[model samples]
Target: MSDPVQLATARELAAAGSVRDTLLVGQRGGYAVRFKIGAGERTLVTKSGSPRLFTGIDAAARVLGGLGIARYRVDSSGLAEEDLPRRRRPDRAVALKRTHENAAYLEFLQQRAEAGRRDTVRYTDEQVNERMRTLRTGRRA
Candidate 1:
């Protein structure tokens, strides 16, 4: 067994009751004191959405096999945890609902416009009188 790596950061984090969020980065005695002893601990310690459990070597293997940790270092360029490519959108139910709503609104607008045009035939008496006056003035009827 080796010495527990003097992780000041981890120690500080553990001291601050951030044990749920922190991980010992180096070896602790013989086993790595990483988040690999329990599933709950692993999930809590891992970068969000990674599948690697806190089971040490097995979890490390999974990490190597495309199960990413999404780690980054301040000094380095950092790793690119590429998203697993898949279909853009599987569900069009909302879009279809919107389309139907738009169509209904459009139909209502069209009907209202048609009704307005039809109603214009029943002009006011003042407008009829004005038209007659214009005709009497020898304007193009």
Candidate 2:
């Protein structure tokens, strides 16, 4: 099993504030622990971690003792067939749970995805060198 995410104490995350949202990315592999403060209402998407990421974070915390920020824990003991039970959080079983809990975060992710998509353009091999040249050396390939 992959590593789990390092969970922080309520106090550790209280500073992020009720309105402020943040991503609890695992230091080693960037797996997300939870949606945290803001994870709802995304208009678009750029990059997203796999659904299994939560499971990995749980695995990670079990392997490593919170890595330095503070004390941490991820509950991994469930008798269900799936180590992680989705029914437990039926309301949030959807890949993206649109709610007050994750509003700001979803907006951030959508914006980044939209912006990145617009900024990047695909080109074929014949146009590759030309595009690279235009991007790097003015307007000539």
Q: Per-residue lDDT for 48-93 in model 2, tens only?
A: 4232244355444542333232334333343223443343666565
lDDT of 2 at 122: 69
The CA lDDT of each predicted structure is 0.42, 0.42
The residue pairs found clashing in candidate 1 are 35-54, 36-54, 36-55, 37-54
Badly placed stretches (over 4 Å) of model 1 are 1-87, 93-119, 123-141
Q: Which candidate number would show the highest TM-score if scored against the true structure?
A: 1
Q: In model 1, how large is the Cα lDDT of residue 132?
A: 90
1-141 per-residue lDDT for model 1 (tens digits): 222223343344444544443232322211123432223443222234332232234444343333233331121122222321223563687788889999999999999999998885687899999989988888654
Question: What's model 2's overall lDDT?
Answer: 0.42
Models, CA RMSD each? 14.6, 23.6
